[model samples]
Target: MLLPLVWMISASLMPLSEVIKVPPVWFAPDKYSLANYMEVWSRVGFSRYFFNSAFVAVTITILQLLTSAMAGFAFARYDFPGRNVIFLIILATMMIPFQVIMIPLFIMMARLKLVNTIWGLIVPSMVTAFGVFLMRQFMMGVPRPLLEAARIDGASEPYIFARIMLPLCKPALAALGIFAFLGSWDNFLWPLIIINSQKLWTLPIAMSRFTEQYIAQTHLQMAGASIMFVPILVVFLA
Candidate 1:
């Protein structure tokens, strides 16, 4: 598992010749260079892709956390009618693959005038069913007596949620945020389908195109993969 990652970073630093040699040039201390990374960054306008990805990922993470935390609190505490059925419906949607609904989602985005725009990549991804489910499960573990005591003291529902519930949900919120950020950052197929303009491409889409445009350039491909992997690795480690 780690070997592939190690090899990718190593090959990314090597020249084209060293990367493609028989048995592979596992290490090339003397020949390592940043030429491939430089070319990838400048030649392909990857800076734009990086910014678009970061913006979309951060926005989605914030929105997902807010929505999930709210929905989870409601599901865990409230006694609204048909709550179980509604929660079931939301969970059921998760079972259906995105591929099954991509066409309809695309048409809806087109109608909303969001296609080929940054929001096209963002709006559809604002809420994730998995996030809601994960948060709901975590919130269920929270004590009911504490919430009741807050209400008995005349604490408003909003205050109790924002001030009390959220403060206690730090671990769940962190996990959900990481999941949302990674999903948004690494997304490719939906962006490829919606973003027609070159300026709207994300890292995954740009990397796909880069692979095709530089098919024979193994060193460049490794360099691009390393660039893409670093963020997820850091977030995962942290």
Candidate 2:
């Protein structure tokens, strides 16, 4: 696992000759250079792709958090007809692969003219089954008496949700946020299928094109791989 990363970073720092050497030489940064990174960053407008991916990923994470939190809270706290069945149906979506629905989803996006747009990337991600399930489990652990006490004190559901539940849900929210953000950041297939313009391309799209355009250029490819890895690492650390 660490070996590939070790090789990538090592290769990113190496010259072309060392990058593709047989048997894969490993050494300290004795003669490493930042030239490959600088070259890649400057050549293909990577900054634009970086921002596109960032915007889409962050938007999806925030929207998913809000929708999941509210829906899960309602499911856990409210009493209603067929609530269990409805929740079960939502969870059932997790069993279905995106591949199964891709064409229909694409047709819907095409009709809405969301194809080739950032919102195209964001809309489908706004809420997810696992997210709802995660939040519900966390919200379930929250004491019901506490909510009832707040109700007795004249607090509304919205107030209780915002002030009491949200604060208590921080750890779970953090966990879900990280997963959601990372998933969006690394998403490739839908973006490739939807985006037609180069200007609208995300990091993964740009990276794929970069690989095709610069085939077998190992050092530059490693640098590109490093570029893709940085934001995820930063988000995880934060």
Candidate 3:
């Protein structure tokens, strides 16, 4: 597995002819150059794509964390009527595949004039059943005594949540944020469907376009793919 990845990187630094030789060149004769990386960055609008993806992913992560944390806190701590039914509904929604709702969601965005906009990409991801479920599960392990003591000392619900619950749930929140960010960052089909403008294209969509336009330039395509994969690789390593 490591060998293939290293070889891909090696080939990406090679010249075009070396990349397309009958027997693929694993490495270049000369020292590695940044020509392929430069071409991908300049000709493919990789910077624009990177910024768009980062912005959308960051937006979704913040919204998901806030919304999911609040909903999870309510579900875990409060005893409102029909609470189980509501949680069950949320869990049921998780079971429904995104494909089932994609068309209707696209149409709704179109009707709302959100299609082809960054809002289209970020809005649908802001609330996630899986995120709520993850947070609720984590919050369930929190002790009732801590919350009760906070209340007895005059801590408001918001105060307790902000001061106590959030601090206690850091690991879970980090895990969820990483998951949400990765999902949004690497997303392709949804962005492709919603983003019509070149400026709004995310990394995956832009990389796909680069591959299509430079079909014969394997080194350049690999360079772009490498750039797209680097952040995820760093996150996983960390």
Candidate 4:
């Protein structure tokens, strides 16, 4: 695995012709150049694609954190009628493949006039049942006595959630945020269907096009792939 990854990075810095030689060239001729990187950036408007990916991923992460934390808090700490049934329904939704609902979701987005926009990508992903489930599991480990003490001090539900639960779940929040961001950042199929404009293309879509347009230029394609991996690598390292 490390060998393949290292070779890919090395290849990305090599000249285009050397990449597909009879035997692969592991390194550039003399010194590595940023020519492939610059070419990909210019040809694909990669900066715009990067911005689009960042916007979608960040928006999804924030919204999922807020909404899932609240929903998780309610499920973990509060009791009401049909609470189990409601949670079961939400969990069931997680089991249903997005592919199963894609058509209906597309129609809903079209009716809302969100198709071809960032909202189309961000809105549907904001509420994730898995996020709620993960957060609720984490929140369950939190001491109820602390919440009771907060309530005794006249702290409301929202205040307790804001002041108490959130701070305690930092690790889990980080884990969930990383998961959500990666999911949104790498999503390609839904974006391809919903987004009609080149300006709205995310990294995955842009990379796909890059490969297709530069099929003979393996070095350039590898550079584009390397750029896509940078954010994910950073998140994992963090």
Give the Cα lDDT of each candidate.
0.92, 0.93, 0.90, 0.90
lDDT of 2: 0.93
Q: How close is candidate 1 to the true structure, as a TM-score?
A: 0.96
Per-residue lDDT for 1-238 in model 4, tens only? Answer: 6887887788888886777787867776584788888977786689889989988999999999999999999999999999999999999998898899999999999999999999999999988999999999999999999999999999988899998999999998999999998999889999999999999899999888878887888888888888888898998899
**TM per model?**
0.96, 0.96, 0.95, 0.96
Q: What is the C-alpha RMSD of each candidate to the true structure, in Å?
A: 1.1, 1.3, 1.4, 1.2
Error of 2 at 33 (Å): 1.9
Better of 1 and 3 by lDDT: 1
Model 3 lDDT per residue over 18-94, tens place: 87788867777594788888888887679888888889988999999999999999999999999999999999998
**Global CA lDDT of candidate 3, please?**
0.90
Question: Which residue segments of model 2 deviate by more than 4 Å?
Answer: none
For model 1, the superposed segments whose C-alpha errors exceed 4 Å read none
Q: lDDT (0-100) at residue 40 of candidate 2? A: 90
Clashing pairs in 4: none
Write the residue-wise lDDT of candidate 1 on 89-177 in tens digits. Answer: 99999989999999999999999999999998889988888988998999899999999999999999999999999999999999998
Better of 2 and 4 by TM-score: 4
Range of the 10 consecutive residues with the lowest summed lDDT in candidate 2: 19-28
TM-score, prediction 3: 0.95
